[model samples]
Target: MKREHIETMISQEVERIISGTDLELVDVEYVREKNWYLRVFIDKEGGVDLEDCQAVSEKLSKVLDEKDPIQENYLLEVSSPGLDRILKKDKDFVRYAGRTVDIHFFQPYNGKKDLVADLVGKGEDGKLTVRVDGNEEILDMKTISQVRLHIDF
Candidate 1:
């Protein structure tokens, strides 16, 4: 099966699993490094804990083992997306609007490679709008490398 298809299946299964619970599926990743890995990122209102990860892992592992979705021998990992989670979906862009984020570009934009800005939201024209230094900046999605939530310590 294709990667996107597999991800969609996983998302659906996870939604069924977490239904009626506070846990939210942040993202599902199927990738290969030295070995194939299926990582499920989950989060809750107050953040996820080790117990939450373990429970989801056990249930999903059982289902994956029974269904045997992927042909390859892979390790399954379930965890929180973390504080610096990347904004991957449109819902994320909307959900995180007005929050501080770190925007990185493939090349310098306005003489800077990256800058901290308040996420205004993703534009319908395949661009992202962010507020920097009190002014709104519309960034071409083609030039953006990454946009993740930025937390100050």
Candidate 2:
């Protein structure tokens, strides 16, 4: 009924439809511009192609149509998270260990607004140790307001 609940439902349905496939749902959003848009971002080990998007879109459309969770007119879109995917959960940090990431803390740490570094490891306490500019810093997980993979240009 609520936006988050709807998103979670859609995410679960998408995950189920793509279970055997390489794709995984990254995020889901229900937004309004002219009409409501239910956007679903998906990713894979390599990447997602248009064909993959089409397949997921078709299947999800059927389920949504049957469930009728959204009362208003909406467009469903399935696509990739692109080069820099945000890391929202602890699993993301563990899965992307050793990759370069940019994390923003809720409060400044050592007078820094952002930290760009290699994800060294996660401590037993759930804090993250990142190597930034050859120095290691322990970032408390509770303080991590946002995190994303750093795409090299």
Candidate 3:
């Protein structure tokens, strides 16, 4: 099977396994470094603890072993997406509203390719409205290439 397909399958299985639990499936990746790694990113309201990771790892491991989804040697790891997680889904956009975000645009907007501001949430048209310099800047979603939580020290 294709790598992406494998990842999707693994993600579906993990989602099912963690359903009703506090854990939420963030992202999944099956990549090769020195060895193939099947990394699953998970999260929760307060944050995921080691026990949560262990529970997910153990259950997902059992399912993967039984299903034999990937026909190769790989290491399965379950963990959090970390502090600066990228806002990939609609839920993320909603969840992180009112927080600072760094938006990378495909083309320069008002002579700038990137903007850092407070997320004002998504509009009905899917445009992202952010608070920039005390003003609301509505951005077309298509023009945006990436959006991540901006971490400041």
Candidate 4:
């Protein structure tokens, strides 16, 4: 199976596995960095703990093993997305609305391609409504490179 298809299949299986639970599947990625790796990122109301990771990891590992989808040996890792979680899905944008985020753009907008701003949810036109310097700014979603939750310490 192709990488994208494999990832999609894994995501579907994970959604089923974590259905009816507080655990929300954040993202699933299969990458090669020295070795093949299948990472499952999950989150919940109070954040995920090691126990949560273990449970998901064990369940997913068993299912994948039984299904025998991948031809290569890969490490299966299940964990939280962490404080600086990247927003990839719509639920993330909605869930993290009003939170501060670090945005990186593919091209500079207003002479800036990187900055911290408050996420105001995605607009209907696929643009992002953000509050920067107490003013609202609409960013073209296509120009965005990455949006991650900003951590203030």
Over the stretch 1-153, how does candidate 1's per-residue lDDT look in tens digits?
888888899999999999999999999999999998899999988899999999999999888889988988888899999999988888889999999999889999889998899999997898899898899988898998989999999
Q: Each candidate's TM vs. the true structure?
A: 0.87, 0.86, 0.87, 0.93
Off by over 4 Å in 4: none
Q: Please list the Cα RMSD from the true structure of every candidate, rounded to 1 decimal place.
A: 1.9, 2.0, 1.9, 1.3
Q: Number of backbone collisions per candidate, in order?
A: 0, 0, 0, 0
Give the lowest summed-lDDT range of ten residues in model 1: 68-77
Which structure among the candidates has the greatest TM-score? 4
When summed lDDT is taken over every stretch of 10 residues in candidate 3, the lowest stretch is: 63-72
| TM-score, candidate number 2 | 0.86
Tell how far residue 135 is off in model 3, in angstroms. Answer: 2.1
| Clashing pairs in model 2, backbone N/Cα/C closer than 3 A | none
lDDT of 2 at 69: 86
Cα lDDT of candidate 1 equals 0.91
Worst 10 residues of 2 by lDDT: 86-95
